[model samples]
Target: MNFHLKITWYPKKRKSTISRRMVTFSYQVKVNGCNILVCREAFFSVHGLQNNQGRLKNLQKYLREGRSTSPKDRRGKKGNPSRKISQEAVQTVHNFINNIPKYASHYSRSQKPNKVYFDHDMSISSLYQEHYLKYCEQKNAPQVKVSKCRDIFNQDFNIGFKLPRSDTYHVCDEFQIQIKNDQLTNSEDIIRRLKIERDLLHAKASAGQNMITQLSKLAKENPEEYLTISFDLQQTFPTPRLTSEPAFYKRKLWTYNFGIHDCVSKKGHVIVWSEDEAKCGSDEIGSCLIKFLEIQKSQANILHIISDNYRGQGQNWATVALERSLVRTGKFKAIEHWFPQVGHTRPPCGRDFGRIEKHVKNRNPTVYTTHDWVTVIKELCKNNPITVVKMKQADFIDLTPLEKNIAKKDKHDDGSQFRFSEATAFRFDEGMPSHLKVKYQYTEYEEFRTVNITKKGRAHQKNNPFQLSWKYLKPIPICDKKLKDVMSLMPYIPDVLKGYFNSLSESKEQSDENETDVIDIGYIV
Candidate 1:
């Protein structure tokens, strides 16, 4: 039924050349019902024994049934003879024509980008060059083959080659093939993130509705039984944040502000301390939560804390351990912590920071010192009353957890992964609070470590207790110029802040405003 014509094996193309084992398939073609013998030899480069046999089988099928009634030759004459190549390879070649080209005029000159921003220097036909082909890796490598390199340029990346600007076809079709494999891959990630974002928005909406209904019911039934708290950190503030023309020159300082919000009542507190005083860490946030709880001792017996998924601050073992400890101490009936998917950080504290910024902008004052910032913020409280807790420089709580943030993965100790993100809910009940569960979702949960009631609750790894003596503080030294600059800005400083300032002076440090000149305070305005 197939290949009635004779087949032949050519042991060598030419005597001088290395022997090329080639197989030719012979078959008959039908043109106007007349049998015509046609033969094809395996390409010299296609080496595998099985590969040649498979190629022959395909040729036999094509021969048994003609592709068309009678194909014309290049000269438009009938049944002259024609050739066929791999459809995939042909398409790749077409793409190379439309998107990227295999050959281009190579420039030998200074660093200049090609049409596709590729700066490599090489001549056209470089892919088929003898030295490059022989030195370049396995015989099957793309660079070693004309069609393979053509396919790569056609389907792999968006980069294009350079050629002289002329009437040449290569110049005109440069960068025509934009495979955009990276963009395709990135689009998938974007789509996944968008889905998660939509899901987060829906979750927040549902949670808000539930919070309203549950809080209202709890208020009516148990009146003063529940509390909801939220928290977020703002970028540090640099001093000399004063509105000054080019003429007004001044010195600047730096500091950080951490704010917590009462979600239900819309009340907020901003915490800023001197560096020698406190470092903001998981433990410090927990301590702040404890202090906030102490202040609300009479307000609610049940606490519900909600914040975005900031690994170190809200969604970690230290905070969970702290909540459990508080519950075991009979501080509340129960504590429930909820975290939304990260990057959806729209909270009261964030809004209030905007308000504070607006207030500062409207005031249009020169913030030459930390006190100046405090005064501006304190003044902000007059019209926009937020409890501005000006923590004494020495009042920083040193007990931030030394442990790393946990990975939000849906896998076990055995190493297999599930199809979901990390836990979103953590709950502590009055009884067995220390052994509470951290839930990935409502349907999944993991148990926490239990602490003995007689012992103080402590975090694993390097944890210094909340209240360490200031004598233990390791000071980094700043230069005399920096010390003089600081003193020039504010003549009188509180003793604790002064010590912290001295430490900064020793280090010759600057905050992340990344500015050298204080008068560049044009942005502060």
Candidate 2:
């Protein structure tokens, strides 16, 4: 039924003998041209409406003013008027995120254009707490909370935290999505294969983790008998980190850090160098391992080393050959180097690196030279200070050629093939100096594929091959453009550090003069 309602304000019928007079509003209801006299409560009950006086007053006022026919929604009409983030604050967040060193995935860069990744060690929380907070302070702007900064990041950016080849398996995620959608063309076969692959990956990762746990326990139980350590190369630290704005755009020298953490003693050791000293290759890694072993020569009879499956660093034939040479020295009765599964290769070294990075983040002093980084690493932990080994050009020994002389062919005399890529673990013992034990999986401790490492018709040498002499590398020259850039940033460097910056030798041929230096803020693997 069509209904029309009218409200009228009227004076009280009986005048009260009080100081103020009383007034009330009454509603006249009409339905189908028939009037109905009812109280406000009864009228609301009959019409299924709330007997709210404030709402009634608002409606009466709207009608009285002739502004709106009915109460307006006003729910979403009024935007958040209380809390408003300024554009300057938002721009600060954007600037910080943009300045963050981003890198394209080496394998999937073409697949994702909008997606860029930073260092795996970095997270949104750390970025907010460590870097963003500092950035806001430096900019003299109001800082946003971690949650708001994270929101801005998710809403405004398509960035991810990752390291090349160290990230989660991309195909596994794709298969999962396909399975979830039930869009697989060959459903049964594809599902079975993908499941098997995924399970294998998981198994490999878990097996590695389990091995580390067992090794740690063994080291703790028998410290003198066994020693377990894990080492990894940290992301390159750009030198001459200055607060000056121009320093951010200029090309900076790179300082490399290789960290080794003892699982039992909980001690960390970092070998530091610059690009001008030597390149971080298998030779440099082998040299660092030699230095570490030298210190632990009288500590333990057996040594267990764990590292990631990066072939260029530790998981290569050169490193294995070096281990074999070390075994020939008879210092370690047995030495084993285990490579953790890819995509899940985090070990004690990762934690060590994290602590170092966090320490660096909170460091108040400006890092000007490689020595400054060394100082930072040395001062990382007070209870168990990290030992810093500053590597010189002479410290890097060429061990790359040892692999060719030791294992000439894939097939050995015993018919066992040596595949360094497939081998997850390598073992060298003084008793079997001519043979190397290999394991395809970390769980297989009892079983091993023994391959004759000595070349055909070559007898094992009694003397240690590495003791006679070492091949030292010459200092690498800095590019002329980079040297020039460093000189330009000399104003930001302290007087004590100016000598080092001035002493940097420029290359005879500045081949990188036209090279575009993308400001990569991420710690690259």
List the global CA lDDT of all models: 0.51, 0.75
Q: TM-score: which candidate is best?
A: 2
lDDT of 1: 0.51
Error of model 2, residue 191, in angstroms: 2.8
Summarize candidate 1's per-residue lDDT along 302-352 as a digit string, tens digits: 877777566657876667666665675567778877664343224557667
Where does the lowest 10-residue lDDT sum fall in candidate 1?
Answer: 516-525
For 1-525, candidate 2 gives per-residue lDDT tens digits of 656676665656775556354555576678789876667776666555774556776886775565647866675455665456778889999999988766544334336646878888899999988899899888898778889999999999999987644554555556556655557755888878777886777667777877988898999999989989999898899888888999888988889999899998888888998887777778788888878766656468898999887877888778877778777777678999888875554588878888888887787558888888888887877887888889877767777556655864576456866676878888888889768887888875558778886777656455453553454433455766777888899777778777776667433233234344212222244
Best candidate (score: lDDT)? 2
lDDT of 1 at 149: 57
How many clashes would you count in candidate 2?
Answer: 2
Error of 2 at 297 (Å): 4.3
